[model samples]
Target: MTFKHSIKTALGGLHSNTSRSILTILGIVIGITAIMLVLSLGAGAQNLILSQIQGMGSKTIVTVPGRQPSGPSDFANVFLDSLKERDLQSIRNKANVPFAEDVMPVVFGSVRLSYQNETYQSTVLGGGSAESNNVMSDIFDIYPEQGSFFTASDVLSKASVAVIGDKIREKLFGDIDPIGKKVRVKDKTFQVIGVLGRKGQVSFFNFDDMILVPYTTAGQYLLGRKYFDRIIVSAVSEETIRTTVNDIEMTLRANHGITDPEKDDFFVETQADLADRLKTITTALTLFLSGVAGISLFVGGVGIMNIMLVSVTERTREIGLRKAVGATNSDILTQFLFEAVLLTSLGGLIGITLGSSLSFIISFIISKFALASWSFSFPYLGAGLGLLVSAFVGLVFGLYPARKASQKAPIDALRYE
Candidate 1:
């Protein structure tokens, strides 16, 4: 029989047992759907994280306290109080780090901010120097929409002045002007000097929800800590990033009195290194989830094999009739094989539609209610892979049943009930 004739016959057979065919490929549909959804969500999350990281610009470098974490158990390194005022001074000195264009020492803590009858709990960021405004403006492109950032005198004198984010301004002052108004931070009243423009989440950190103050004020009166949590450095140019990072490492090592690089109490990371690390982490997580979803496909393949075996047994007389005429064994085999492939291929199509729809809905919900940065993405590769895997599954599982049906003797099959 011709290939087209076999396909027609196989489809007719499937149509005749519509309910059974649907049941047989149910697992395949579910498996494909899972694979597509997992891939879509993974891609969306990776894009959100990477976009935030990229917003910091390519020439930026971050220096964090504590030894670099080598394993999960070393996560405590993040909380270590290793960076101090002297360390910040060393990094800011042009003689020590000539390539460094800007530096900002940062320390943050949760605080209760209150104005009049309003009270809200929010994170307060302490910036070490007045140049922090320049760093934020130049590298992050963040500037105050109202008033301006605090001056160098404010930081040096540990002045109780604050720059509030858009969200904070809305919650505390509402329509009233917040500039020159006083807001209490940890029992000390600070004059609101500026209001920052809306800057959304960056690398999972919500800048819009936090208040900015001088690191001196925060360390002295708010957080009651002398050490900085992190130090941000911007290179003069992209080419100077490596040199700046090296200078920072050298400066910190000298201050901490560390002779060996392995024993250094701090870690410095460039923007490129951070981006690569995030990509690797997200890719590994996506693959692991995909592998888990593949189990359903394996189960579906087994189901296809079992159903095909049963189909062959039930159609023994029909096979005998076809062979009794001029139909060859190859013709009978191809017909059965096509039936199996058709079922799985149909399942794959259905799964692609369902998975894509579900992914869209999930993405929409997340973006609307959670992070606005969350986005919906089409899983084109996942859809293509699902279809290919479905076809391959049918081919592998249907072979035995098709061979069995083709091998049945005409006399024996004709005599069977």
Candidate 2:
């Protein structure tokens, strides 16, 4: 039989039992759908993470108050009081770190902020002199929409000044002007010196919901700790970042009286290092999830094989009659194989459509409500792979049933049913 004739015969047989044909391909549809969803969502998540990391700037480096964590058991080291006033002073000295351009000690905690009867629970970021605030503004590409950032004098005197986010202002002050107002931060009252713009997120921080204050005041009054959680350092240029990181490391090691590199209390990470680490993590997670989704495809292939075998048995009489009417074994084989491949390929197309639609809807919901930075991503490679895999499953699974049908003796098959 011609290839076209075989395809026509295969299609006609499937049409005779449309319901069964649809049921037979359901497994393929589901498997492909799962794969596409996983791949599209994974790509979107990776993009969002990378974009946020970029907001920190390539010339930036951070020093955390602990050794690099090797496992969950060592994670507590991250909260240690290793970065103190002495370390901060040493890092700021140009002689000690010639390439360093800016440094800010950071501390943060959750607090209930109130304006008279109005109250809201939010995070308070304690860091920055006015110069450092400007550095932050430049780095994040956001500035106060109303009023101004706290002055350098604010840090020196531990002044009761606070810069609130847009959400903080809305929740506490309503439509009233927030600048120059007094708000209670934990036990102390602070004057609202500035209000940041509606920047949704930057470097994984939701600036729209945070409050900023001088680290001195935050340490002495709010968290009641002299040590900082981390120190943010900026290099004069991107090219100097490596030298600056080395300089900062040497300075800190000497200041802490650390003679051995492995015994160092603090850890430093540049933006490139952080980006690479996060990318590796995201890539690994995506691959793991994709592997889990792949199990569905294997299950679907088994289902197809089982159903095809049942189909061969049910059509035994038809196979025998075709063989009795001048049909060769090769012709019968081609028809059955064509049916299997067509069913799976059709199911694959349907699955790609359904998965893409669902992924887009989910991406929209997440971007609109949860995170503005999130975006929809289409997995072209995944769609192509899904189609090819579905077709391959049909070929492998349908072979046994096709061979069984073709090898049937005409006289035996004709009399059996």
Best candidate (score: TM-score):
1
lDDT by residue for model 1 (1-417), tens: 887899999999999999999999999999988888989999999889888988888888989888778789788655478998898888989999999888888888899999999999999988746654465566566789998887677888899999999999999999999999999987999999889888887653577888888888998899999898888888999988888899999988888888999888889998788888889999999889988988998899899999889989999999999999978999999999999889999999998899889999999999998878899988788889889999988999888999999999999999999
Query: For candidate 2, lDDT tens digit of each residue in 156-225?
Result: 8899998899999999998999999999998899999889888887676778899998888999999999
**Candidate 1, clashing residue pairs?**
none
- Give the whole-model CA lDDT for all candidates, comma-separated: 0.88, 0.86
Which structure among the candidates has the greatest lDDT? 1
lDDT of 1: 0.88
Off by over 4 Å in 2: 76-79, 130-133
Candidates in order, TM-scores: namely: 0.95, 0.94
In angstroms, how far off is 26's CA in candidate 1? 1.4
